[model samples]
Structure formats: C-alpha cells, structure tokens
Target: MSIADPVAVREHLLAAAAAGHPLTYSELLARLGHPFTRPRMRALCKTLAAVDDAAQADGEPELAVLVVRQSDGLPGQGWWTGSWEKHRFTGDWTGPDARLLIDRLQRQAFRYWQERAPG
Candidate 1:
C-alpha cells in the first residue's frame, strides 16, 4: 500500500495525537520513512482529507489538522480552504486567530485519540 494511504497516514496522526503536538509534513514524511517532496505532500493531503471525512462521520476531531507546515507549524493551503464547521476560522491561515483555531483542533484531536489508545 502507498504510504500516503489513509491507514498509514492515520498511524502517524495517532502518534502525533498521543504526543500532544502537531506533526510537520516533513516530520510525517520521515516517520513514514520517505524524504519530503511536493508530490508526496500533495498525495498525503488527499489522504488526509479522506481521514478527516471519516473522522467527521465518526464524530472524531480531525486528525489531518495535526499535520502542519514546518515553517508555520500550521496546516497548509488545502486545510485552510476546506470546509470545517465544528471549529471554523474566517481569518487568514496565519497570525493569532489561525494559530488559536489550529491549536484548539489539535488539542481536541490529541485528547480524543489519547483517550482511545490502548494503554
């Protein structure tokens, strides 16, 4: 299976959630044992959306939001443009407002996944 498949991406997302922090795209690439590349990032983003779709259906916080840009430590263009009703942010995808929104979602994902993880 491709590393960018939802199941593989989710394993890394679960790790980030358990660690209580966001994971950079590059960092997630490393975890998946691949070097970073735009094509890879793009592929990952597609799978991430799928993961989030499933999460939304299950009433789970989005795990994809925990995958961020290494530069800003926040999600990229795709996430910024996606539809999110639970925790919407109308501000630009930077600055305090965006950070706050991302942080809140990441924290929610962390709590949800950590609680569900088998000890």
Candidate 2:
C-alpha cells in the first residue's frame, strides 16, 4: 500500500487474479488504499510488468501475467497470459472501462484453463 512497496502490490494483483473474479485498476487502487494519480498508475503498471517479466525469465511461464501498453491506436492497456493471444485482458486506463476489460480477461482465463484441464 505504501508507495515504496512493490512486493505488496505484486502480491495483491496475484491474489486478485487467482480469486476467480474480475479485477479493475480502480479496485486495485482501493485495495492498496493509496491515492490514485497518473504517476502512481504508471508506476504500478511498470512494477507489475517487471515482476511478470522476471517470472517468465525464471521459467515460471505459467505464473507470468504480462502487462502491455496498447500501441495500435487504442487508448488502453492490457494484461496477458503466457500465451498472450490466448488470454488477453484489456481496458482503457481510465474509469469504468477497466472493469469490463477485467471481466473479459477473467472469462478468457477461465476458458483457457478449462480447455487445458485434464478430464
């Protein structure tokens, strides 16, 4: 929750994702109990992306959650599974848009896992 606590933020995100519920950036900020600002959002995104990258590099591909900035003329950002296209989570960087994106992402992740699950 503290501005200096990347570990807390990382853990919070992982837990949220694992809860089998959709999550939004606003919800994430509320969980952190931190003031929301453009700079803070940027920092949080950067930190999460770094953590995901490190996990991938460590051969924990399944645990990786990628954060990407959209550059195709879309005003949004997104997260992805190890196979990015298989489970992409995207949303505008503002307001209620993130909630919709999170919902879609959760659904995609659910479908992905279900398809891969052993019968």
Candidate 3:
C-alpha cells in the first residue's frame, strides 16, 4: 500500500502517457515492476491529480478551485437545496479506494471521515 517509490511510478506513467501510449492499471504496475490491486490504481488517479500542479492550474494561481451546488448559487446563502453539489476532491476523499490510500498515506482517517460526513 505504501508507495515507497512514487517518483518512479509517476515518471514512468508520464513517460508512457507522453509516448502516445495509454497505460492500463496492470500496465502501469508492470512498468513499475510491482503488482497492486485495482483500488490502488484508483487512488493513484487521485494522487496524480492532486500532486500534479499543472493539472489543477487554470492560468491563475490565486484562485483555488471551488465546488458549488450546480442547482444553486452557493451553499447556505439561502434555503437552497441543490440537486448537484459540486466540490473538488483535491486528494482528500478516501473514495472506494480507501484501503489503497490508507496504505500509501497513513494519516488519512480524519480526512476520510470528513469527506463522508453530511454537508
């Protein structure tokens, strides 16, 4: 679960992706000379998204991504119960791949709980 060599995996994935090759879960792990469960791959997807600043930037470093209810202007501004509440995960959610994330990073219990709490 612990990604002792995340740098290597990241580099390999980037290289493979840049080479016009789409890496499957198994392919990615194989390239890393390791075997991981499917959940680990999902967690890696989140991890990659979080760690890669380029993926999060929108030409402005000052503005952080915000998630608002699609059905309403914002939360708690009014009695708006929106059907679509949007929030950026930002590598906080444990998701269904919780086990993998926990294995990689140990101090995720509180974060995972907060993500599951009623908003």
Give the Å error, residue 12, model 1.
Answer: 1.1
Q: Each candidate's TM vs. the true structure?
A: 0.90, 0.50, 0.36
* lDDT of each residue in 9-67, candidate 2, tens digit only: 65665564455443445556667886667677666665666665665576433322322
Scored by CA lDDT, what does every candidate get?
Answer: 0.84, 0.49, 0.36
lDDT of 3 by residue, 1-119 (tens): 33334455555544443342334555555565657575655555444444334423532111101111233212111111211132222332323442343232222322333344454
Top model number, lDDT: 1
**Winner by lDDT between candidate 3 and candidate 2:** 2
Evaluate residue 60 in candidate 3 and report its C-alpha lDDT on the 0 to 100 scale.
Answer: 18
> Candidate 3: RMSD over Cα atoms?
16.9
Per-residue lDDT over 26-101 for candidate 1, one digit per residue giving the tens place of the 0 to 100 score: 8888888888899988888888999989888988888988989989898999888875555566788888999888
Best by TM-score: 1
**Regions more than 4 Å wrong, model 2:** 61-75, 78-119
